[model samples]
Target: MEPSSSPPAITEPAAAGSGEPLAHRRLVFGIVAIALLMASIDQTIVATALNAIRGDLKAELTWSGWTITVYALGQIIVMPLAGRLGDQFGRKKIFLGAAALFTVASLCCSLADNIYLLVVFRAFQAIGGGAFMPTATGIVAEQFGRDRDRAIGMFTSIFPIGGIIGPIIGGIIVTYWSWREIFVVNIPIGLLLIVLGLRFIPSSVPKATSRIDGTGAFLLAVTMLFGMYGISSLGSAGAEPTDPLFIVAMLIALVLGFLFVRHANRYATPFIPISLLRGRGFGAMNTINFLFGAAMLGFGALVPLYAESRYGIPPLQAGTLLTARAVGMICVAGLAVFALRRTGYRAPMIGGFVLVAGGMTLMSLAPHGLTPYAWLAMAAGITGIGMGLSIPASNNASLQLAPDQISAIAGLRGMFRQSGGIVAVSVTTAILNHATDAGTTQAHSFVVFAAILLLMIPITFLVPDHRGTW
Candidate 1:
């Protein structure tokens, strides 16, 4: 594959105001942040409302889990496509279209009377939500060229902000209203984003002239769908790792994945540019990002259930506990931006993983009897702080390393993170399903999460601490 003579350059739009660049940048940030928050919050908010959805829809417990699975599937499948599309079309156009789709989908989700219908609507929602993150990141990269680290840090921080708040907000809404309210809430947020985004978001010229690799895209989608679905299935009750369906899905994923890679290497412009992965810095950052995703998202799924079962707390109370984790992330992110300027990336990256490992270990060792709520909150807070530090550091490193491929790399990074979340959910669910006792299951899962995080500490050493030239 030959490189195009003219690759897309990330450029800033003309200022609309009285030469106030800061104000213009802030407007751009606000537009992207709102889109990012809407997308990120939807990822976890549904977890708290799953039971309510199941009961109201009269859906089987086993099948109802597809609500989350399908939404994730949409995200995994569309992220790369969204990035490529934004590059081929205009980022502003793609962002607005996606945001509109997400808003309409949310309305449809609230009206769905059956679980299957709700799941379908959720996928549409995911399509819009997934596109928002990478595209928004791309905008930040262009708008804050020299200060991309600080801007990226602020943008990346919204992910945990939404993650921390989703369940709490979901719980409150569910407690006061109906489960459908969860979807209903997104309607206003999404609509407002669409209106504001069209007015304020800057337009960019399409960068790519190459035709998309349809075959490569299809093959890659097949690999992710089968692989993720198979892994998630393993978490079901009485599920066997050796189940025929699981084995078949895994086999198919492997074969299709190989085909996709081969096709990508040959195609002029593949769905995902495989060359990006060859870079040591980009590759290493993605690997650590994957681990972070698994630990953070996986533990997030387990905590509410763990809290509810261990303490006999109501769903609302259990969800509220997640606020501690959010608070930790917010606080660390602010400090990390300053710390990175003074210390560079290596210290925070290593220290962040250490904190994550320690927190998970603490959670695993919680007393078998009724664990104190304060103890749970503290452990979660520690883990959140670690996540807040590491994720942005890694993301900033990736952006700095591959400034030319901002949207594409951002999408790729998202794919890795979401994939980790999928795997984590699957692995933990399987452990929980197989264990006879709840406490033991939770401990085993935490240990597994901690072990994965510990691997990141060594890997972080491999990441080049390229402090941006201020």
Candidate 2:
């Protein structure tokens, strides 16, 4: 494969050197951004609605959490495959198909009458969503042509704002209407993206043909399913640390994953593509991303727990406190574009992690009173800024290493990041469960967790700030 000249940034149709007018080009990218926001927001929206969803379905507490796990597990299995599929076939077709699948699944989720059915539908929804991340990243890269540094920076920043808004919207809808409204919201957004995408998303640049690694895909699926199930089972009453069945299942998953890695290296086209993993900067960025994912989950799970437990707030109020945090994230995410452009990533990554660690640590120190709102707000703002800043740098590093195979590699990165979230939730929940006999214990346990996460700061510097080609 030879390096060809990069295309111009496709801000408008003329910028893309297309026959279309400037208005049409802006219309195209605007629609793509909307589609991207819809998909990313859905990932976080359901977080705030878990309690209502579980109660309505009369699900066991442990089972209700699977609503999150099942969706992520499905994505873990499908993301890598989507990357390769998009690379081999075409990004636009797979993207549209995935969007349609996502819309259908969301409708099914809205209509679900049973907990089991809802979980199944959510899994299907993830299969659709898994494609969106990689394909969207690839599309952004393609649209920007060679000027992807700023484009990637802006692209990465937008999703954090979506993450910020999702919980608030989910909370409002579930509070005023029903949990079903969460899924229903995606319909109009999905339809709009589909129509616009068909009109504007460009054809993929032709590349070397690659075979689909079916065996590797199957093994990867097995690995993720068992791994996620094991994670979900932890911190729950039914799964004991010494349980033989649980131990055996975890061992099996590990064994299969090891085999998959070994086999993938030998294949002509590995499911994960070992070449991507070998890049020093890329590998380090993923490691940091995995840890960051875990920290994000800890914050995600802890915020609601604290709002409800300490403040004696109801689900809606607990969710609203989370909304405050989202508002902070939205404010900071926009600044990230300028930050990445003006200064290099090192200062921001280090500073961001420090802020997150500081914020989490401070939250650990929250007193049992209303006056702490100031401290809470400060913490939320700082953490959000840190997350916003760190994300663009990490994503930029990952893209730099694998420009040609952006979709596939990005998908694999998503799998690791999401898996990190699953693990963090499971492990932190387990720790809290073991440590918390009461409210005080829960608070103390959280402080301990936050302190430990603070230790992850030194590792960030190990990541190289490689600015990959546009």
Candidate 3:
């Protein structure tokens, strides 16, 4: 690491008249928020239509699950590379490129006639979508010269906004129109982001010496692919963890994963710096973000399907189950923005985890005498509140420690979170594919995962938790 004597990347607050106009800064946040919204919406919007998509495209349940998994898979694979590229080529360049790719790919997704084509398009869409967080965050870090904490804390609220809109819009489209409409929805939003981004997003200095680590990236990708295959095997009829395919795939992934880490440790310029993986608070933060992903991306996507299978809820209402969660998040997210400094990171995060666990446990019990929809919605909302309480704290906690490498830190956080989502979706599908009663099995899975989430609480102590900047 650079010696403490080195000048910091960002110095003291800008003078009253030194920075860009306040309105322009607001416009910039608006642009990045909208970009994030479009991508976040895509994440939840498709969940409501999983069954519909499967039926329309004539895909097997296992294959249909790929619609979600592949997107996350694409994201995890591209994120580290995206971070480096942003550093080397300027954040605005990468941001605009990502927005354009996401827009074009969404159009392709809407036009796909087969499941294979749709999945391919979704993966391509993810290539762009995956870059959004790292690049937008770098842009935000530069623009928010002062009150950085408040600005970033507020940024956490944007996802819940997308979370709220995605499922509701998804429900409506899946209920009355074709599922294809979901992807079509992104076209205009993406275009607007691109146009505004081109005109308004300020450019950051590129690091001429930044280098990409192709070897490490390939190993990581291969490892995940093998691991995904192993997980998918468990969903097969009469399959077990010890099945030859599962064992072989997972063992290979394990070996490769080890190698990837070893490579990162030794390489002069690694794909993701080893310190980010194992450095002080960084390692713990990555772990927390990974688990958080299961709560945010995994839980939201599966609820609609769970509600449908378990209670025979219509697509419209089932989709709102996610909305309920987002609503609860909205309730707490605003508070987090203003109150984060007072509560610090650890308290809110641990509390959030407990709430998430409690909410999941609540969802599992549709008691003998209650309305399932109300009960589940309440449960989801509780989970949302838990997430809202923690998100800003977690988002800012890691960045504060490494302000200069904003994009890299943000990308690493995103990679772990998406990795968690991938694992969650994979496990859920694997179980559903083999289960006799999918709904019952899935509900029980929620309780089991909730228990695991609760078990993860002690690890939060390892995370950084100061009231102000690190």
The model with the greatest TM-score is: 1
Residue-wise lDDT of candidate 2 within 1-470, one digit each (tens)? 11142323343223334423332334445666776688778778887788999999988876777787787788878887787778777777778988899888999999999889999999989999888877776666666555555655666655666776888898799889999999998887787778767756766643446767788888888988887777767867646667676687799899998999899889886767777765556667777767777776556656767756665656655555555665666666557655665656666777767777776766667555545555555566666666766666666667666577788877877877787877877776666666644355555655654564566566656655543333
Task: Please give the CA lDDT of all the candidate structures.
Answer: 0.78, 0.71, 0.80
Preferred candidate (TM-score higher): 2 or 3: 3
lDDT of 3: 0.80
lDDT tens readout by residue for model 1, 27-83:
778888988888888888888788898898899987788888888888987787788
Please give each candidate's TM-score: 0.91, 0.86, 0.87
Give the clashing residue pairs of candidate 2, or none: 400-468
**Taking the candidates one at a time, how many backbone clashes does each contain?**
0, 1, 0
Off by over 4 Å in 1: 1-23, 310-314, 367-371
Error of 2 at 272 (Å): 1.5
lDDT of 3 by residue, 1-470 (tens): 22233222332123112443333566678899888888888876887789999999899986787887788778787776787778767888999999999999999999999999999999999989989988888777667655566777787777778777876788799899989999998899898888888777766677546567889878977887788667756656677777889989999999999999999989998877788887558978888788877655677668888999989999778877877888888889889878877888888888888898899988988655668998988899899899888788888888877776778888888888877876776678777877799899989988877876786688778876778533
Q: What ordering of candidates by lDDT runs from best to worst?
A: 3, 1, 2
